[model samples]
Target: MQLPVEIPGLLNYWIVIVLMMVGFFVVISHGNLVKKIVGLNVFQVSVFVLYITMSKIDGGAAPILDDAIKNYSNPLPHVLILTAIVVGVATTALGLALIVRIRDAYGTIEDDEITNQERDDA
Candidate 1:
């Protein structure tokens, strides 16, 4: 049967939505610090994919001065994504380091357990 809209054209968007939801679910449903970090990374990746997908152009060429190249895709999105990747890596490293410190101090990485310990201490 013919569908209402073209599926192939929007397939990338569907994938991005699915990935975004999965990442969000993982972050919301899990209590483990590492798991949360993983979820965040998944979410970050989905966003990166979204940006890249949106920046794509049909029959587009690199931004270069050429008379034959009438259509030139914007390079800003790619550059921004590259910067974001570096920032994401640094942020992940910092997050993991903080988690390590939290584990050492609380003796657990689970959020509920840490809260319980704090409650008991207080």
Candidate 2:
């Protein structure tokens, strides 16, 4: 008995969609700078998963030259994701550092509180 929709085959896509929506919701609904940064990282991870999912091929082998291997998985997406992971780490670190500075100056990381403080000062 076969199901009309193949849940197993499309599981990765479903996961990506869920993660993307979760990340987007967190980023938009939270006012804390640190939470926003974390949300951005989550979103970035979802995109990484998306690319990796798109690159996968069933029964595919590595791109190494071989006489018998007919289908080879493309390595470009994996390589790009590796680079993106490094960049994401760097960006996260920078974002956190800036948040630290903001906290130091304002004594709080909440966006609304910061704006209110600024208005009070002005």
Candidate 3:
């Protein structure tokens, strides 16, 4: 049922856009690698929300092969989302591990300090 002058139930995308912007800001504005990974996580979470939202068919049934309604979201998007989630987790883990290693190597987690130390060491 479309409204006379406005679209019905269109409040989800704003959240995604906000999350996307926040993630982008965090990733770009922050100097710490850990903070960067945190931002990346927020960014990935927004993508996950976008994917799940795409999978939800309005007034549609699940993807079960039943004998009733025949509408369901395509499985490929969902599968891809699942795989993406796994990849995001792996990436975060690897990034965090690298940050820990960097902290150990430079004795500081601050990006400026690390760069300055590297210059001094060289």
Candidate 4:
């Protein structure tokens, strides 16, 4: 008899889900713009992990063509994930730069505080 939730089998999936939720909650629940940017990065990483996990095959070797190897893990997804990570890093840098500018203009990085300050200025 097997239990519904097998920790060994689903550990990686569960971890990914937890990371995704943490990122989502941080983005939605945080008042700080910098924290939100960090959360977005976290979410991106979880997506990368998911892709990498799906591409991995048990007892599989590298994608290099080899007569000695019958099973090879697909490399396309890993390549895509690498590209996505580069994009994500660039995006996070842009977000941080914007946050710095916002902080300079509003004197606060908190979302609500910035909104209130803008309202008062008008």
Estimate the TM-score of every prediction: 0.84, 0.86, 0.84, 0.89
Better of 1 and 2 by TM-score: 2
RMSD per prediction, one decimal? 5.0, 4.1, 4.0, 4.8
Worst 10 residues of 3 by lDDT: 1-10
Best by lDDT: 2
lDDT, model 3: 0.83
TM-score of 2: 0.86
Can you tell me which runs of candidate 2 are displaced by over 4 Å?
Answer: 1-7
Candidate structures ordered by TM-score, highest first: 4, 2, 1, 3
lDDT of 4 by residue, 17-108 (tens): 99999999999999999999999989889999899888877666888777988888889999999999999999999999999899888789
| Clashing pairs in model 4, backbone N/Cα/C closer than 3 A | none
Clashing pairs in 1: none
Q: Model 1, residue 64: displacement in angstroms?
A: 3.7
What global local distance difference test value does model 4 have?
A: 0.88
Q: What residue pairs are clashing in model 3?
A: none
**Best candidate, TM-score:** 4
| Candidate 1 per-residue lDDT over residues 55-104, each given as its tens digit | 86766688889998888778889999999999889989999999999999
Evaluate model 2: give its lDDT: 0.91
Q: Which 10-residue window in model 1 sums to the lowest lDDT?
A: 1-10
**Model 4: how far is 42 from its true place, Å?**
0.6
For model 3, residues 1-122, the per-residue Cα lDDT tens digits are: 22356424555677788999999899998888899899999999989888877776666566888888578766667899999999999999999999999988888888888889889989
